[model samples]
Target chain A: PQNNKSVHCHHPCKNIHVFQKVAGIVIGKSDVKSFPDRKNIGVDRFTFSFTVKDSPDFFINVTAWGNDGYINLLSGSFSVGDCVVIENPLVATKDPEKGERFCPTTPSHYRLLVTEAHSQVYLCADIDTMDRLLPLIHLPVKDSRDFYSLGDIVANGQKLDGTVINVLAAVKSIGEPKQFTTSDRRKGQRLEVKLFDDSVSSLPLVCWDREAIQLVQTLIPKETVLFIADVKISFDSFRNSMAATVNSKTIITVNPDTREASLLFSYAKEASESGALDQDEKPEDAKTIINIVMFLDSITDVYTVTQLKEKAQENPEAFFGITYSFISKLDLDSSVSKVIRTRCTRCKLQVMEETQSCPNQLCPGRDQAFSASTGFDLLVDFTDHTGTVHGCALRSPMAEQALGCTTNEFTMLTDDQRTAMKWKFLLERCKIYVKILPSTKMRTGIRGVILACTRADPGEVKQHMSALLQRL
Target chain B: RQTQETLTKKPAVENSLRILTAVIDGMRHWSQFKDKVPYLFEIFATLDSAVTVGRHGAKNFLMRDGKEVVQCVFYENEQELPRLIRGQVHRCVGNYDRSTDVLVCVSVRPGLPSELRNAQEAVKACDAEMRVLVKSISEV
Candidate 1:
């Protein structure tokens, strides 16, 4: 029998094997975590985990265990997104309580364990020769001390809309990075870090570059002060405010050894101690808040449609949230045109003029006969006390659930029957889960899809409102 | 024996339309009967379906399962057509053309193969509705 391991692992769980060497790009690295050893009482044990992926679909969690100094040294040697090679590691089955509690959920059934005596980690030395490999961020533009206060940027928001400037501020909070695929199937990631200074309470600084997101991922919220040099300033007309973008010309210095940065850092620590900073919005606080509410499993960060609009404008990253609103407009009673569309089974594109091939020029099955299925494509309006959102997409299978019928059944209903069905949801309050996307081309300034739509339970609504009030 | 009756009536195309609905809508797959209805059918095992609109605006498609392949034809009732999901078993209900073995659809929708045994009423209702549509098309 051949003993060679295949690139596609059949099932890593079946056998425990020692990997001589494995190389992958580090996607995430966590801070060094320590716990008091239960068996040793007086002694402490330290461990840190990082995730590496050789391909887009597969990534494995690797943890190193050693004394405080050794674990710190190993973790600090490589930043996220670096191509790193692990030598002589044991592949062990994962413990759900220990592994998944802190680390990301992975498809691999087993994780790599790195120990002090048996394993070593190295940054791939061959990376430079492979120039096509992801590029390292340029070193923070060699110590330019000049910077702008958050207050200054806001005061001159219009004038600095298109200019480059340095900003010095303490991290108020950092949001989880949002990963999305563009229409062309290209992957993109965005992270938003909220910054605050003595002059300004809060300003969103966005990180769109991959390396930039990884760098900001390591910063401790409210403890680290950033000196961002040559960052682009853009005036957001949607929010009627200003925001900064980190780009190629920008270099971020974490905890810069400067008098101003040090001063802001101390101020941040003081503000956090005094309870002046609102910590409720942070994901870390969600666990305790969840325990108190007890019914928060289905709900996440609830917002009124008006607040929802502001939230989308505040950060470029996409987010999911629930809103209580009325179905102000549902076009079921109108002409039954375009409500049901035939999509080419091969490419899933709309077939316009009844061709026998996919409309997509590059579709794999373009030369084959075109097969299509019809489904509901609906546009609806959601209104709350704050405001109304126009043209929110309510598409199939969710649309089928809300209307209580299949596409075949819907087409059979007369206009009067459709109108009667529409009236049932038209003015009634509904609890709608929506995925909001900041859209520039839309007249409403924001676009969204209704993930779920159903009638709101009055008692549940009251209870949810009280929870929000208690938090406030 | 049943295919012979269908062949004889194939020449009276206008009569089939005038009597539709009942004549075509009530028509079942030949495999389903020992007696002849107004039409014939060819059932396929694998699903290879396509819907195309011709120059005069008639929409048609082919249904092919590996065991056999059959054609279905229609016109203007695009809204009435069920969205055929790929990879699911589907059937076309139309009078069979013995010469071409085409299922000129009368638009009857059968419940999926799994549900067909229990969905006789739903199928009956569907056949009635499509019969009206075919009758109107013939008048046009």
Candidate 2:
């Protein structure tokens, strides 16, 4: 008592001894209460409570406030279970009974400077920030809000939604024709596929189209990026987990959206890891895209030189050369020409002539589009047993070679390899179809030509065209 | 630039921690530890409003600078304690009735040591109840 001296300063606790700092060990802490109050000095006090293990049977009262001018500096993101260390504690007290003498308690008069703030403290409230808050490990949102109704749970049907999420797996079976069953109980074609990821290697993907199914026969799991958007998930008969059911409505293919593109890029990287890449240095279906090319055949009609010219009216570069010459010979009405267009996949420049460079130097995707002098006069659309159609054009020597071919030869697509060749040579508009092609040499020695004007499916067109294709 | 901005800002919990720690450390009469201070106590109490206990009660808490805290009630009991005092700070000095037993504690936080409040609550519970009067040392 003799050594006690009254001192005045900005804070009450600043004059206290060093040994009096800090109470219990930094152990488990919890929130008991938090509220707002105003001090007699016209300052606001936002009170908070914390429970500690070692010291103090009574709860610690902490007022969360600063001077009036600095109130805006506080963060609103604080939450429960956040472990915080306080520096420079202060305290104050008051009379418990109305008529009782006014008394002060040492513990109540304190100010603590908060040191470290962790975002994990608010993890429960902000599910969206998990990636930014959590470090190192990759965590996918398993709260069912992000899932696209497609695919199944990797683990057996455990808790449908929980924090302990580990694997996000989807069905990857190549559909087998034997498994194809329509809602009417009619059997169609199916392709079986296996699910795969770089994390776990590979699985199966089931494609229902005959050409796609046939192509899947030779496809390695590593070389495909399946974007099953509206795939509805159903409980298996065993009720072990939810699985994907592909009907005619299932769009089990890659799309151009960022999410789907990212999936494919990763898938391609995974395929490359498994030696799925060919000598040609082409990216395995699942590889990241270094570049992209976008061309429109027709919004309403199958793409043709006339449609391309109309679409390409903005730039002569995409239309003038081979596609233009072909359009000039055809007795196409101007209305048809306006329906389709071709432009640089990179710069969207309308290509005009067969040249190595575009008129706009910055325009990429610039290359000799087919050839200028040599133009294809014949257009053939081929449809397979599965109802998917693909179209191709033949000109000069190739058309002459096919002029005398029989219908059987012209429409022959006996295997998946042939389907892939037609797709590789004639079907550049579709990336997903190219990714599903079978990996075999059967298509290396094939060609087809048709004299009759019959429309066919794009998927079948890929199968019928057997020509040892010029480089695409 | 961000670091500079952060360094200039004052902390949020400076007031409560300062008041709590100062009284706990100043108290010297407890049989459990050396001197009158036998044991150490740290209590965490949260009232709905900072003024839930009123200006007199807050000032009284500040007056006990170094004494063992007995019980701390954070929740309100309107039926138990009626006619609570209105908590006010930074008003004109002449308006306050300092001559009487009731005096509003308007002192700013004295900036005390932090660890004093860190004293265990269990230690404070073990102490004898000593009534420490709350009185204004200065007009401000």
The sequence of per-residue lDDT tens digits that candidate 2 reaches over residues A1-472 is: 0112222343333222441233322111221122344334543543222321122221233333333323223333332222233344433332234201111122333323221231111113333333322221111212223443222233322122121212233333344345423446545554555554433333234354443354346544444444443333432211112344433222232322246446655766655665643332343222211111111111112222222323333332211111100101111112212212333434445455344545655432223332223222344433211112123333322232223332234344343433333323231112111101111332311111222121223333222221101111
Clash list (residue pairs), candidate 1: B40-B96, B45-B65, B46-B65, B46-B66
Native contacts kept (model 2): 0.00
Scored against the true structure, residue A218 in model 1 reaches a CA lDDT of 84
- The native-contact fractions of the candidates, in order shown, are 0.00, 0.00
Pick the lDDT winner: 1
| DockQ, 0 to 1 scale, candidate 2 | 0.00
Q: Note the Cα lDDT for every prediction shown.
A: 0.63, 0.28
Scored against the native two-chain complex, candidate 1 gets a DockQ of 0.01
lDDT of 2 by residue, B7-106 (tens): 6652221110011111322332221222221122222222112234544333222222223222222222111222222232111110112234222222
